[model samples]
Target: MPKAKLKPDVTVFEADQRQQEAIEHLHGPMLVIAGAGTGKTTVLTRRIARLISERHARPDEILALTYTENAAAEMRTRVRAELGGSETSQMRVCTFHAYCNNLLIRNGRNFGVLDDQDLWIYLRKRIRELQLNYFVRAANVGKFLFDLNDFMRRCHDELVGPEKYHAYVERLVRGELSIPRVTSSRDADSISDQEVLGRCREIDQVFQVVERMLSEENLGTFGHMISKAYELLNLTPELLSQERAATKFILVDEFQDANYAQVKILRLLAGEEKNVFAVGDPDQAIYQFRGASSAAFEIFRNQFSQSKVVALEKNRRSTTPILQCAFALIDKNPAIHATENNDAAENGGRRFQRRPLLSERDEKAGPAAIKDPVHAVSLTAKDAECSDIVHVIQQRRKQNACQWKDFAVLYRLHSHRDMVAEELAEAGIPFSIENMDISNTAEARDVFAIMGAMLAENDGASLFRVVATSD
Candidate 1:
């Protein structure tokens, strides 16, 4: 596929110079620190467009990496529209794993790696050989570990440097054995080992074997891919140089959510050039449980000589009171590293307008017999009509009255829907429940309609064959 064309020159608004630097800066490692709703994505999209238009980066060479498929799609759609391209064919956008798989598959023969389908089987077998006991015991512990590692990394980034965090992790790992020894030595009357615990240990041993094999193959997991991508690029100077030459600028969104592996990948890709821009909010960095290292953001200036940090504190969501409440809660986090500029502290100091939530009893108070303008009527009975009226107010607040797609219900339990749904019906509000089994719902009808449409075309036989094979 050909490269994506550059977007037209346009001045993009970033809250500060740091944001502008991230959006307009070309080449090299950079970081932008902002709070939630601080236009991080907007800055990132503009940066990508700026690189293509001004920096002359080829669409293929400029790899846009994201954490999820939904995020990738969002970026791809934006880039495609901005650059004007055959998105499906030209855009080389994907999550880190997807990107690595593509790289391995396309260049697999160069590294003696298997094809995509075969690679999965190969990795599974190798992981089994690794014999990682943690994974074997719970079957999901490996994922949990990765998540926990990410979260820990983010916490470390926001509080301390990676070196300190690394040391902390090492100490924790070494301390695990001491607890059991200490307990055994202290209590001579207690049994040496519990039977159930022994059985669990045996399973752990089996998992360790599987984990050992997986790590040995070096086929690469998500963490491995982020780590290996850097190594691969660093080793291949020509390819690395080509990417640097083609793409003048690099911008990363949600920079706080970046783990060490991702930071390494960005550093390698950026090389010595000072064109890379990273943007994220430290306050919304709740993903530290994943391998997202916040140090990449908190310590970017320290890590890179040319890096500049920017803070965007304006909030687009929440009222003044709501923002004040959230700020008050977030201030309680002891681990939050303060900035020299003290923007967060200054912004948070402003008092919020008071707006108290009505008590359940107050809300349940009945409407008075008098026509009141200043004081609102309160519920006083278990009357369904009054409850339904209240429910409508609550439901409308949660779900907008736009197209059918705009509405969604977030219920704690399925039974909780009856009252709200009945209220909606009484108010003549329209909604579609998406919880029904898709096979028995309108989705099935739509699928059949599309299938019928396809069958009417010239390639009807292929469709028929597929249906027959499925059956």
Candidate 2:
């Protein structure tokens, strides 16, 4: 393979030294600790471009896994821009689930895997058959199905199949396993050990039924797709080897948000070559509820002994003050220590390598020119807080002559929005809530009426709705 060189005309050549280093690194397991506002995507896309342009690897041999479809599309577009459509057409840039789905679609028939939609439909159809001690009533069937789906997804993400879940629940039943009593919320009732065990047993029962149904019908869910792919690869060394041979370079974006099954699939695909490039910030891991591992960074380090760690600390977006505020907040995490040795074994052995963000923006230009970028406000009550927000918006609009669309109020919770919306309405200020249901809106009703009129020309109700809504 030729040494990867940065061409002066290439955008990657203009990247900072650290980014250039990360891009130039062609082999071995590497971890890029990309903090917020850092150009991780730019580095990742350019690296792919360099790999193809310098003949280190062909576009088809590289696999880039991203957290979202948008991210994957952006990466593909950037790589295409750098290397052109002809050279980059064969490259694979997709989400972990997408990759697994594709893999299963191509090679999963040998192990009897069915489509995810079919699996879901089967589960819904057979939900009544899975007799459970709790949530078995007709009224609670919907809740049971929802919880069952969530539980199954979590189990699959953690690589815990029905057998594993059943075994674990049996241990709990036999008193071999114990759970610590921790109240998740002050207002929530504390669950007893017996209650926990009961729920676990019920979930296990549902899980086993679902698994059996899947086995009998060869049906699989989205989560099962990933798990089944892992199983297929692990059970068949020849197939695994073939995949590893085809995949010369593996680049994972948002690796911190990757679940256990995703990491396992990556491990199998990377194999002994370990030509894996993972870029993520552990602190930015916000998908724990979705089964993302908090110890993802540590797991990567432990799995790849020859892994090289790099930090992209230069934030191209935020100002110095904003960076300082962010640093102060994140530095409190024990994982962000400078270094961890035996002395720090008590503190989870230092999972992260600290990289303080530095602002690349010019202090005297644009938004960076603002003297006070951050503000702290304390309100004694929710009512007061909402009032204060309304006051601020009104004052800002009056002072700057800004339109209502130019201002935005963000709430940490949807519940908080109700009071704020009421406050804004009382103040005669117009605002729109993101993700609000628009089905009842006048525009949506108008569209629905038009559609109904077109589809049901003879229906009196459809004609009435159209006439009522029309000008």
Candidate 3:
């Protein structure tokens, strides 16, 4: 493929100086610390466009990867628009899973990694075969199975193979051994080794059973795609070189969410050229439950020689008060990134080491000049709080044209859903759950729907649907 033409002068593209600096940096590895609403997707798309248009890079040679397909699609749309809808069709715009899936499909056969089948039935059967039904009630079996599945995936994400997993099991079984690889969570120190050991054994057994079944049935999991692809690349230098040659430039979005396997795979693809452009905000990482490591971004920045680091702190989405609230949380002990050091100026004046946040949005957002309109309401009892909320909503609707959907009640736990749904139903509220499609997966859930219909009208079918996916 021939190289594409460059984008026009500065006047053609209106962006912040820092954003332009990040986009213009088309050479070696570059890291952009894009805070929330700092136009991260915009920066990423524009950066890729600049690489193709201005830097004369072939579209097909560039790979832009995100954590989600939606984000990838959005980036593609923006990049195409930036490049005037020319020379962007072949650019690899996809999620990590999609990218890994493509690589495995084309080249996995030689590595004993072929196609994979559905995991839904395999999971249900495994739960029965392991006698997990006895340990967990039938209603909670789905939760047990799903949790086991997540544990297995996390293990694979950490690159813990079955043997090492079995080792963990053996040590746990013996009840006298030190575990390797301490968890990176803040709760790590407080967690009991035996508890972790028991869970590790459970995860290991699931891994063994599920993997064996997958092998017999010619099925593969998403974890297989990542781990096996890494294995394939490691065992075949020609394949690696070919892959690297095909994609001369790689742009990784949400780099802070990269785990051990992702970091390794990215490094392998980067090769000697190291033409990786990663963008992410460490302060916004919330996927650690899925084995994501924000430190991966820091490690990449620290290891790469002469890597350019750009901080995009300009807030265009939220009010200045909201930014202040968020930054207040981010500026605390663990939230503040190690790279941010305000005292570095006194130490050696090295690049003025600290990079603080800035908000361009108006401070008038919170109406500081006016007295607060907040009020307090006392309920007859704790249970009456629901009635109070419904009453307030009704009042708001009458006075301000507020719809039922205009109000929201967010809970941190799925366990909190049933109570809220019950309250809403009692109050005749028309609010809806954001993601209530759990029962849509697997045909066995049809039985669940039938059972749900047979149950009482107030049995919380919506909550049942959410839980049935796991069951």
> Candidate 1 local accuracy as lDDT?
0.52
Q: Model 2, 1-471: lDDT tens per residue?
A: 444443344443357888888999988988888899889988898889888888888889999999778788889888877665534668999998788878777884423332333344446666678877756753767655665677788898989998998898888788887763423547335667877677777777888887886666554567777888899899999989899999999999998898878888888899888999999887888787778754777777767766777778788877778888888888776563222332245574444556578777743375636456778899887579999988998898899998889888988876797899999999998787776767755577657657876887544434444554445
Q: Let me know the TM-score candidate 1 reaches against the reference structure.
A: 0.55
lDDT by residue (tens digit), candidate 3, 378-404: 777867766677677778889989777
Task: Output the lDDT of residue 138, model 1.
Answer: 51
lDDT of 2 at 339: 23
- Provide C-alpha RMSD values for all models, in order: 11.5, 8.0, 8.3
Point out the higher-scoring one by TM-score: 2 or 3: 2
Worst 10 contiguous positions by lDDT, candidate 1: 351-360
Residue 175 in model 3: lDDT: 64
lDDT of each: 0.52, 0.76, 0.69
| TM-scores, each model vs. reference | 0.55, 0.74, 0.70
- What is candidate 2's CA lDDT for residue 359? 75
State the local distance difference test value for candidate 2.
Answer: 0.76
Candidate 1 wrongly placed segments (more than 4 Å): 1-22, 55-58, 80-92, 109-208, 215-221, 234-247, 299-302, 334-429, 432-471
| lDDT tens per residue, model 1, 39-95 | 677667767765665545655657666766778888877765566553433545667
Residue ranges of candidate 2 with Cα displaced over 4 Å: 1-13, 84-86, 108-127, 134-145, 173-175, 179-199, 215-218, 334-355, 362-369, 377-471
